[model samples]
Target: MTQPFLSIRKLRKAFGAFTAVHDVTLDIPRGEFLTFLGPSGSGKSTTLYAIAGFQDPSSGNVLLEGKSLLAVPSHKRNIGMVFQRYTLFPHLSVAENVAFPLRVRRRPEAEVKRKVADMLGLVRLESFAERLPGALSGGQQQRVALARALAYDPPILLMDEPLSALDKKLREEIQAEIRRIHRETGVTILYVTHDQEEALHLSDRIALFRDGRIEQTGTGEDLYLRPATDFVAGFIGNSNFLAAEHLETKDGASTIRLADGSLISGINANGAFSSGQKTRLMIRPEAFRLERGPTSAELAVEIVDVAFYGERRRIVARTAAGQEIDIRPTSAAMASQEATPRHRRVFFDPGAAFLFPA
Candidate 1:
């Protein structure tokens, strides 16, 4: 078997009496884009820092292409990094900033000049080569930072919420540029962010952290559609988790009794559930339909609000048990007359719903 391009073995980090990262074991193939996603203090950034050698792990090993990196100094590790804030020198021109890494290694002047030009062009900032860091917008400064990180042609690049400082529009614009640069450079990237949509958009795979350990890791679709736990379902996307009791399970499908005394069978169960065990049903908002199908179940709800949202209709409704749930259906599925404050029956396929322990 070919060894993984990058392997993290039982990586852990602690600060005094607190453990920031638990034993995290992950393997990444060369040139893969992986994101560490979680909320604040969840250890996503801490794990990235360990890889970047910002701090030594209390225990465990970090191996790149089979060699251990623990003893290597941060500057000697030969890894590139971009951070939440642009760390460019205010007195340096964009070209000088890009060339700094090369100059540090005492590369010939001609080589530094050529590499600087290539890096600037790669980030589409050739026109701004002479511009000072203070004159550039937040987004452009970030692009310059990206250029600097790649200027040395490192095998691995670590990004710690590099786009968090930009406005929404500029953030999205840079996301596209990052994707294009990744394609063109084929650099192995490990990014850290708490934004689920950003992770889903940019990553080939995501490792979601909770507390001090990884909750789940896979493609965005895997976590959204086949979540291993209730936390995974709630974090990856919007979901309506209704209270229920597990009645029984047969052939991997379970029957559940909802809070309002309604029975729903054929739900995709996360694990074998015993009869009479309390549980919750997770159904995505988009899964709810206005019309019922042969295999779908119905829920009686009182419409609290409805509004047109371009191609989809946003609905806020309350269940018979007084639980408010969100529902969004395509405009084509909802007629103008049906968009009103009244009692309605929402339909959803049992196969699309997941049952988890309460």
Candidate 2:
């Protein structure tokens, strides 16, 4: 196999007695959009800062192609960075701000002008080129910052929660723009964000951080569907974890008994489980079926509440053991039913759910 384009080898960071990032290591392939996703102070941003040269790691190496980046200064590392705040020059016009990097590098005036115009067009900010930073909206300013970061065409780009400050609608809009730019430029991107949806939408792979360590790293679907741990299952999406007791496992399948004493077989047990071990079953809200199938685990539930969403209706139900779980059924599924059944039975495929140690 070829070498990784960017290799974070056992990266760690500490401040005084506190450890911010703990042995976090990952390999990023070329032209790959990898996201560092986690909550605040979860070491996501700290790990990104180490790669961007904004913060130094206490120990470990960040290798680009095969060279260590530890001794390189932030400016000389040839990495572009976009921050959460629009770090644009207040005095410079949008066009000039985008051209700042090339100017500092002392490129030819004609080449600088050409690259600046191209980057402005790439970010869809050519119309706002003449405006000052104060005159532009928050989203527009950030676009200019993006254009500036890519003006010199660095081999790698680092974005540190660049859209965190924007409103949801605007954040989504810029996210689309970023995805388009990544496709066009093919610059390897390492983006950091606390937003799970943003990470799912933008990244080719995600490294989920929790409390200074990496919980899991995989594609969005892998992390969501085949989660390595309960933290991954809970972090990637909305999940309803029902308590269960492990029965046995043969081959790759396992049997478990739910709290209500219903036996569920053929479930995906992602870990080793001894007989009668306590376990937790992970069932996504959309995994529950209102109708029974050939291979379905039936559950007796009391409908507590139902809310209508355009695409899907949300229903909250409680099992006989008083376990609250959420289920989402499409509007078409309920179109035939006259009224909400006070006592309802639901079914779910064991293959779609997971079992983890409690």
Candidate 3:
């Protein structure tokens, strides 16, 4: 197997008495897009800074290509960084901004010009090379920032919420541009973001952080579908969590009783959950279906609210137990069930439900 390009071994950081990052470790493969996802103050940014050598770790080692970077200076690390703000020099033209790093490296003027032109073309902003930073749009300025980061031909790039300053449409546009540049250049990236959708869309793998610790790390689908912990299940996406009591296991399948006295049979227990153990059944909003099958568990609910989301309809239902459940149905499925009144019976398949020990 090939070794990872970046290896973080038991990395830790603390501010005075408060530990910002606690024994975090991860391996980022070469040319892979890895994202650190979490809420504010979750240590995601701190970890990124530590890896970039901007913030010293309280303990542990950061290795790049099997070499420890403990004594390396920030500027000498040769890692490229793009922050939330464009950080472009307002006084310099786009071409000069992209050439800043090459100049710092004392490259010959001829070579710097060639590299700056290539970088601008890579970002599809070759035409804007002569324009000053103030003359370009926010998105264009960010492209310049990206071009500048790549000017020196760094092996790894670190982005800290780089797209958060743009509007929604512009953010998406830049996201695609970033992906394109990553593929074309084959540069490994360590991206940091709090947006779940962005992380899911951009990362090859995601490290979900919480309270200065890594809660879980997996592919987007793994974290979304087979979450290892309840925190991950709730944090990754929308879920309907129903309380249940574990029952007997038969033939590797475990049975659980719901709050409404409904029996739900699902895969085996995740941990050492035994009979009578408290559990929570997790089901996505779109997992439930409205059907008339007799074998399916029925719910007595009232449609309290409805929202049309182009491709699907979002329905908020209040169960007889007074718990609110969110359900999403395709436009066709919703049309087929239009005959049902506001207060109606809804049924869902047990196979779609995932039970997790609470």
- Tens digits of lDDT, candidate 3, 122-215: 9999999999999999999999999998889888999999999999999999999999999899999999999999999999999999988998
**lDDT, candidate 1, residue 97?**
94
Model 2: per-residue Cα lDDT over 147-249, one tens digit each: 9999998999999999989999999999999999999999999999988999999999999999999999999999988999999999888899999999999
Which RMSD values do the candidates have, in order?
Answer: 1.2, 1.0, 1.9
- In model 1, which regions exceed 4 Å deviation? 336-341
Best candidate according to TM-score: 2
The CA lDDT of each predicted structure is: 0.93, 0.92, 0.87
The number of clashing residue pairs in each candidate reads 0, 0, 0
Worst 10 residues of 1 by lDDT: 332-341
Give residue 312's lDDT in candidate 3 (0 to 100).
Answer: 92
Name the 10 consecutive residues with the lowest summed lDDT in model 2.
331-340
Instruction: State in Å the error of residue 309, model 3.
Output: 1.6
Judged by whole-model lDDT over C-alpha atoms, candidate 1 comes out at: 0.93
